[model samples]
Target: MSGGVDSSVAALLLKRAGYDVVGVFMRNWTEPDAAGRCSAEEDFADVRRVAEAIGIPYYAVNLEAAYREKVFAYFLEEYRRGRTPNPDVMCNREIKFGDFIEEALKLGADFVAMGHYARVRREGGRVLLLRGVDAAKDQSYFLHQLSQAQLSRALFPIGALTKAEVRRIAREAGLATADKKDSTGICFIGERDFRQFLKTFLPAQPGEIVNVDDGRVLGRHEGLMYYTHGQRHGLGIGGGFGPGPWFVAEKDLVHNRLYVAAGRDHPALFATALLAEDVRWIAGAPPDRVFRATAKFRYRQPDRPVEVEVLDERRAFVRFEAPERAITPGQSVVFYDGEICLGGGVIDRVRRPYFEARRSAFGDVFDRVLL
Candidate 1:
């Protein structure tokens, strides 16, 4: 349940709907806090108490081994290659919808449920994923990896309710997590001081921060892995009494360098076409031709108009009608047609006119390593 207000209310809603419910707290990882870091033991305790109050059997299932191989390992690999990884999306795919669902089935439960704000439905004998009614908190992007089988057996009771309504439901039900703050960062991984977390796994590879327009050194960074796309602060480059702030333009993984510029007006961050791989469709098949839809590159971004064309079974190309900034490789690009989630994949490349010119200049190596 993650000891969150949403999940607790979801369980209560399911219980009232006459479903035989069992509260499960999946233990994905137990991070040893560094000298001054804090743990979330109390959060687990709170989840346990809520389970007791609901009179449902609760159990902690350890998924650490699977999490390491499937989620954490991928996360490390992505960063090592200078790409931002979404661990939550991988966790939902590999551990939650995969292993956790298997465990639930073994326990003879008819459905496995979670706090995700999304909907599931069956149409023409196939399961379809839908966006949550609460657009502000819709989590279908993270859930894009779920198969039709998983969708059929999953329950998202809070899908139709807003966050405010969820809190009210929890309070009226006398749930302990009624007023609990939303858990941030990676679940079970605790609140990460991100730079500190990277230092633990990736060795300090000090590099220069250069200007994208001119290859002039501006500052230095421990490693490119510590930074992400669209970051404006902590560049270590002092733009004292300037008219504007600097934003990260690029991270050269091979040369171990970062590029920054002191303006947000640059077109470098904007993308017209995004190429995605590691494709997973709810129906296990790709649609033919270009399909008009709406897509969101990140979880919080509003889904905007796009055209998705399947390049192959394993790859698809998404072209935004207008440029979307910071279309980072390794992040997801989830497609939706109305409320139904068409599915999504990992962003492998951004197709821009300038990028094409650079690719032509550098040849195949540029295409292979830019991601």
Candidate 2:
């Protein structure tokens, strides 16, 4: 259980169905806050209260060592390489469904359960991962890296319930987390300053912020890791303001410099195609030839039509029908056929034919910029 209303209600629903429900709170990451406090302790207490109230056997397991080695190490490596990686996907794979399931089975669990807002379908001995009934709250995007084996042993008890309905059920059950605010950002450091938290691990290296169009130096940034592609806010830039404030257009990680564009619709922010590596298809390998499908480059983005070609079992080349903005590397690009999620892989590179030439001659040539 996450000490949240979702997990608590999941356990309750299973209990009502006459199944042997056991609440397991897996303490995965224990990164200390700036105040030296670990928030996992607070969550543990909440889980205990809900598990007791529901009259089910509750237990806690410390998976800190495993999480640090498996999930956290990968998270830091991605940032070091100037790529944004989603640690939640790694946590779900290596820790939750991986280690947690092994732990749960040792405790005699028939099936592992989570509060994820996604569903699983079994037909003709083929298991399919489907979007939850609550489209607004559908989390199949995050779980897109899951394998067939993981989905086979997994259960999402609250996939059919809307967020409002889940909250109402919690209130009716008098759960402690009925009104608990939804957690956002990384679980280890909740609501803390993102850049400041990242600096704790990734050393801050000062870099120049260059305007992408004119190649003019705007200002200095604390570190490239603190900024992301196409981000408009948090940049302390001044002057040269034409269309609006500057946005992060790219990161010259090799030179330790950041690139900015003046307008939101700047061409520097869009890409025609992207390359992804480590593709894992839940159903199995997709057809080797080029195929049309829908994909989401980021979690909040809507699925858009794309042409996908399976370069290999672990990689693919994707061309979006429409130009995609802020296609950052190291983020997962999940594929889908209608409501059925077909796994995904981490983005490796974005192909920009127009920018590729300009990016090479950026620093020296100023007047040649288009906009």
Candidate 3:
């Protein structure tokens, strides 16, 4: 719940529905701030206030060691390997539904309820995961990795309400978190500077920022670990070929070099195909080996038409209808058949154009593209 209005309202709704409602705030991160205080403590205080206002029994479960081992350790490892893994997806799969659900059942819980902006329903004796009614706040992407058993025991109370309506409900109920700002991004790091925070764990090794289009070393980068695909800010690059801003096209982990491009529309940033590994289908089984669907490589990306060919048990190739820009490895590519999420996987690598695989600036792979 993290002491937010959404979760507070979730508890209220559950209690109203005649269900035994208990609020549990899991303490997964214990990283101390510069002031020698754990931010989770402040969040726990807010949880307590919210729980009291909602008139429910609340408890704070310590999951720091488990989170460090399962989620945080893998997050650092991915960065070290030059991949930007989405910790939020892994956190939902490992922590929220894994250890936390186990704890809930031990307390004789029939099911676990969350404030996630997603929906679940039972259709033909199978529980289905669906997008939230709020299009702008739909979180089915992060919830894509959830398994059938997990979805069966999960409940989302705020799935139908808009963000504004959620706040209004909290205010009407006189909940303390009524006006609380929604927490964005990863929860562990909060609002800390990413590079400075990462330095505590991974010592940055400065490398030459090389231009990808032309073999030109423009400037020195702080570290490859601090950068990701299509990043333009905080790169410390200046005075290139023209009065220009350079974007991070790629990170050469082998050479420890950061590749930069002249502009956002650089050809090197686009990819027509990608290989996805570590796939998880929410339906407890993969869909057809070869199927056409819409996919989103990043959370903010619109669903683009794609043709997926499942290769093995947990691998597949996705050919996007249009060339995707900066299809970074280690990010999840969620596929959907219309509004129903078809599930997806981690991007292992992306395939761009060479001489034999050239594409036009408008994303046409050949001289003529089919309508």
Candidate with maximal lDDT: 2
The true-structure Cα RMSD of candidate 2 reads 3.2
Q: What is the lDDT of residue 140 in candidate 2?
A: 89
State the TM-score for model 1.
0.93
Q: Report residue 189 deviation for candidate 2 (angstroms).
A: 2.0
- Please give the distance, in angstroms, between residue 344's alpha carbon in candidate 3 and its true position after superposition: 1.4
* Count: clashes, candidate 3: 0
The ten-residue window of minimal lDDT in model 2 covers 362-371
Candidate maximizing TM-score = 2
Instruction: At residue 136, give the lDDT of candidate 2.
Output: 86
Tens-place lDDT digits, model 3, residues 173-268? 988889988878776777677788889899899989887765688888988888888888888876646645788776766667787888788777
Please give, for residues 58-138, the per-residue lDDT of candidate 2 as tens digits.
999999899989988998999998888899888888899899999999999989989989999998777788998898888
Per-residue lDDT over 270-362 for candidate 1, one digit per residue giving the tens place of the 0 to 100 score: 668878999888777765567888888999788799988898877988878997777788899888778888889998877755456565543
The lDDT for every candidate, in the order shown, is: 0.81, 0.85, 0.83
| Clash counts for all predictions | 0, 0, 0
